[model samples]
Target chain A: MSGAPATIKDIARLLGISVSTVSRALKDHPDISADTKEKVNETARRLNYRPNALALGLKSSKSNTIGVIIPEIVHFFFSSVISGIEDAAYETGYNVMVCQTNEMYERETMVAKALLDHRVDGVLVSVAKTSTKFDHLTLLQDNGIPLVFFDRVCAFIETDAVVVDDYKGAYMASEHLISVGCRNIVHLSAPENLLIGKLRKVGYCRALEDNNLQVDPYNIYLCDTSEKVEEKIGRILDRHPRPDGFFAVNDSTAIAVIQHIKKAGLKVPEDIAVVGFGDGPVATICSPTLTTIEQNGYEIGYEAMRFLLDRINKGITAIVARKKVFAPVLVKRESTARRFENR
Target chain B: MSGAPATIKDIARLLGISVSTVSRALKDHPDISADTKEKVNETARRLNYRPNALALGLKSSKSNTIGVIIPEIVHFFFSSVISGIEDAAYETGYNVMVCQTNEMYERETMVAKALLDHRVDGVLVSVAKTSTKFDHLTLLQDNGIPLVFFDRVCAFIETDAVVVDDYKGAYMASEHLISVGCRNIVHLSAPENLLIGKLRKVGYCRALEDNNLQVDPYNIYLCDTSEKVEEKIGRILDRHPRPDGFFAVNDSTAIAVIQHIKKAGLKVPEDIAVVGFGDGPVATICSPTLTTIEQNGYEIGYEAMRFLLDRINKGITAIVARKKVFAPVLVKRESTARRFENR
Candidate 1:
């Protein structure tokens, strides 16, 4: 070794192993076998290599900062994810720069370039609802910036992603409503442009088909806001056949549906059982509470950041894209607490 | 005019005024009088000066990015503030980098250094609950980075601050409770180290004294969290001559107090009126919707960022610090909808 100090490259050279393998072993990466890790450790001890050498190698280009892009910061789900990302980053001596797109594609594109200019080491993104083009996202990857998608992913980019099992969550919600003796169900869906939107609708249809119930396309409405509920819900209620249960895309929409149902002199669960996705604080605070799917935002964010950091450290850009899906859980509340005998 | 282009200095020289004054007038800054603004605009038109020249002048060191540091992201108030900051920044072609301290002083200091390293043009901050020392914040000023304090201000730092009128808000809340026939009102306050904590306590006491009621120190409890409420509130309720009302530091604490009061077989407003600060979503969602003070988080954030951007543009570091106080509004709801008979 030179007078200065031994590096990871020196350890790899002494052990006759690849530099990447040595780096992983030093970090005790699960992919690296224990035997290799032990060997790397022994060689590192013999060489008297300092662990900070690994960081020193990337210090020149590394800003020790990560960028996070989300639709909105005031949102409960996204904010929880940010909290998770910040906590995870803090543990490894990294800072986070967060940007909100306000669900605008142009703004998302604008902020992406800003993050690039800031020279962040890696990026964790949940694409905006209005984002259709992937050029801006691809621009980040093209510039050799590591990218990880969480909650929402761009199909055009082949990168690591963390997504909730929206289909399964929606399916479970529909099934629970059916089990509670709901014969006619409605889905307050998201925009068709989003993958999760289509998946959730498909799941609702699948649940109805499996239960031998009619999967009426007319029952599914692209009503995800209070204004939409006000505009379209009255007509749906006044129709010859009314929905007995509602599965909303989010808790806010579900709460809105409940309010509308009550305004029409109806009781939840008795007249219309309701289930929402993303069991945020409002779920418990809403009247009769809200039975919803827990998206586990914090876990998703932490895992996504962890994955992005790993990939950035490994410095492998051409590797196959990785995907991690988190399971969604159904939380029982008064909104869906109804029982009925088998028909 | 030179062959290249006209600049603010040229216009200032023509008008025989300082460059700073000319720049402020061009932007229609409130400090600049209307006469100065018209003169500056008239001179700029005659000189054929491009507004982009102003941006070009600061382009060398300006990252077009601002830093925002708050205690937490999952919090309703802070997240709303972030939304406001992002929107304001976005409107002006600026990006925001947000950091959360989790209320830890060490983390706040570390993130402050990180923002410094990123060379942000300016920073807007809400001091962490655990932060007492002002060295980390002063470091930003030392590095020529303009700083603006919002919501939570550091007493030692000499800079612009945007704070809600916490004392006046608290006074209004206690007075409202008194009007609703809550004679023996207990105050659930924040930590004494916080300025808001002291101000709110004083406000509550003054309200009591003004109403000809005794300002009992024993009735003031240093409780701000649900865990603290669980631990201390039961004892407070069980005390002889049990308190008939509760004034809490924030909405969450007030909600928790309401829950405990209900568990103790007391009816809201009718038996015990409760008032909280920060009229968040939970205030309306809670049963007998809470009557509280609206802190106007978005306005505060927007004003703070705008102020910081102004400071950054003018490039003035040594001056008298400015303070902006937002008046808190009392939002009446079912929680405090009681009428009192003549005492």
Candidate 2:
């Protein structure tokens, strides 16, 4: 219970060995005999000896750690990405420092500063909903710190980025609805200020145009929360000429739409087909299941870390800023069938 | 593009100022004029100067980072908990260093050692599934580093722990099922080697005893995966007299059980009532809207972090090794209903 720390000298004294011998043993020096090293290590363990990392950091200037900043960890997409990043970093003997922005711009900026303060060699970031600026991110790059962006990214920042083909995913969802004999399809949109959201909206519009369907701006409803989504869907359902199909931005909101539809005594696919983006767990667990676009969150996370590590090792002089985009795959489930079929 | 690091002297030379004045302005010294401080600050910003954190760490001996070890980030429960932890930590200017064990005991031990090597002030741990031994955790505590356990914990370690009232939650779930007039009840359990599993089972037994119902060993099944659970539930249902009620340890498994029961041409509440633990999003979105025991995962995370920070601030001199148990609430939904009224 003593506040005093145990050092190499303490272990050496306890084991009746010289300080140099104890140090060599602790460092696995070849000159030290295996038996003597083992005895010294055992004694060190017994005495609860922990080498000071601060002193080591001062000597080596490398902590072997990376910082990761994301909007929210609870989201299915980000968590999958984090899992992949952790796997890659673990293999390389690197630890990840994670921070959540909670979709706040101020929090995102704070996390960047905190990561810098912690001396992380590099950072992996997914910008928040309100993050329209890039001064903090640019500053990190300017200071020779490697930065990588995944999912939601800032277009102005010149850094390695990993993004899913949001445009293509939205286009496919809209086109699929058209292929399934739906003309009036409502696109549930998120905030329009971000790059990903704008890209997805464009994709949805292109799909409608290509299919010779009228692109009614009224059909594009901007909703963020589940309650708003339910209210919007309710209003949509009560219209004079209701939309035959719906394409939602994310799975959680898509599931909410399905729930509201069910509560109104209407069956999915029979009354209105729904396609959701992000094949999250909520999609599968929902009744009738959700037909959605499946992006490889884990691959994005893994590649982002790999790219950041490469940047860190090669230095800023060796490589130019680059962006990597992952394509989304369509997962056919019961939600968008020709007719309603209860499992 | 220069490999050489820019210093205060270089900044002062570029701005035509003294090095002492530059340093003073950077530190916001009172002697520095406002106009001169602004100029120095602007020049430093234009050059993207960052003070070395390693030097600071050496002087302070505190890394200002907390190491976090979780079983998996992909799981909804752990991810939600992490969000809470991140929210709390960021408010206190603490950054989180994260590692995933993937439920391997060896990986858990390695992460612990690595965190220690990186000089983290403390560790927040959720033990892995294969963690049967406490020797690795003991190594951390013996080194004078504080440790806090949340969710999946090691019972042998006498330290601060944050846990939900698993026993009470399970008891409530069982009692709810019995009240819905389910005479034949089965408990879908996780691995019984862990404290959580054992505590939940005890609660199930207590509920049965309180209701004057005999506990049948055959009614309890251990399931670790969806496939294993489906197979086990299939065998139980194939029996002469099938169980009319089910209580699952977690929501994912509960959803799987419900899905399997539906495949067998049975309806929830009408044929069998189901109650699941962990009132996750899946519980609400699932068909029939799962009746579940709700534990505030975010609150548990927030409180756990507060407890750890308190301990970290007080250091080893604090004698109170506190354990806080959060109560779980039962969410009544469509899955459990009056047996006599249903078809």
Candidate 1 residue lDDT tens string, B1-343: 1123356899999999999999889878999999999999999877655443114312464557789999989988999998888889988978677888999999899888777655678999998888889777877776678899998888877889999998999999999999988889999998877888889999999999999999998999999888899999879988889898999999989988888788788999888899999999888778878999998788888999889988988774645689999999999999988888467
Positional deviation of residue B258's Cα in model 1 after best superposition, in angstroms: 2.0
Please give the CA lDDT of all the candidate structures: 0.85, 0.84
Residue A78 in model 2: shift from native, Å?
Answer: 0.7
What is the C-alpha RMSD, rounded to one decimal, of candidate 1? Answer: 12.8
Q: How well is candidate 2 docked (DockQ)?
A: 0.57
Per-residue CA lDDT of candidate 1, range A161-255, in tens? Answer: 99998899999999999989888999999987787888899989999999999998889999887779889889888876778999999888898
Which parts of model 1 are misplaced by more than 4 Å? A1-59, A316-318, B1-59
Using Cα atoms, each model's DockQ against the true complex is: 0.19, 0.57
Report the lDDT tens digits of candidate 2 across residue range A142-235. Answer: 6667888898878887778999999999999999888777788888888887777888889999999998889999999987557778667778
Give the Å shift of residue B341 in candidate 1: 3.3
TM-score of chain A of each: 0.82, 0.89
Model 1 docking grade: incorrect
Backbone clashes in model 1, listed as residue pairs: none
lDDT of 2 at A281: 80
